[model samples]
Target: MIKQDAASRTIEAIHESVRTYLKQGLTNEQIIEKLKEENLEPYYIETVIDNIYKEYEDKKNLKNAILTGSILVIVGLVINMLSYRLSENMNSSAFLLFWGIVVTGIVTIIRGMILYRS
Candidate 1:
């Protein structure tokens, strides 16, 4: 029982390390390099590093999606404001708002899809 407990704890620690590496956007090869510098067992370090790289790729995609969506939303806001002030007719102002909404919605949907896929 004591041995089992110790094994479980060790596994948990390794998993946490992998999670940290993934969050930091480390590639599989990058993680392997880092792990090699540590004093961990060869097999254990390699396995964890491999898994972390796969997971990190997915997470990095999601992060990029979010950034793209945020940029679109900000740009849409600027366009909406500038268009509203420059327009002379109510129709043009409304059209600008519509375009802004469409852009914001498209970006948000893209971001959601990426996050869901990840």
Candidate 2:
């Protein structure tokens, strides 16, 4: 039991190391190189690295999508406001484009949130 406990702790430590390296903004190659010194099986290292990196990338992408979406929505609203202020009867095509930007932003944010949750 003692041996098993020690081994489990060691495994957890290794996993934590991977996360730490990732948080430090190390490149994938750098992380892999660091892991290579741990005497782990190549496949094990590859699997762990891939899974962690994928999660990180997904999170990053989701954040970017939400931010980009929000900016687009704000820009659309501002443009719409300015257009109306300048001319009460704005061009239909211009309004259409602004509305489209807002819709696209909404879709992007929704998709990002959904994908992150899943």
Q: Each model's TM-score? A: 0.50, 0.63
TM-score of 1: 0.50
Best by lDDT: 2
Cα lDDT, all candidates: 0.71, 0.83
Tell me how far the alpha carbon of residue 20 in candidate 2 is from the true structure, in angstroms, after superposition.
Answer: 1.7
List model 1 lDDT by residue over 1-118, tens digit each. 9999999998887778777877888876676677667767667777776665666776777777677777777777777777787685555535457466547756775876766575
Any idea what lDDT model 2 has?
0.83
Q: Which stretches of candidate 1 lie over 4 Å from their true place?
A: 1-8, 16-47, 88-95, 98-118
Off by over 4 Å in 2: 1-14, 23-40, 89-97
Per-residue error for 14 in candidate 1, Å, reads 1.9
Report each candidate's C-alpha RMSD, comma-separated, in the order given: 6.1, 5.4
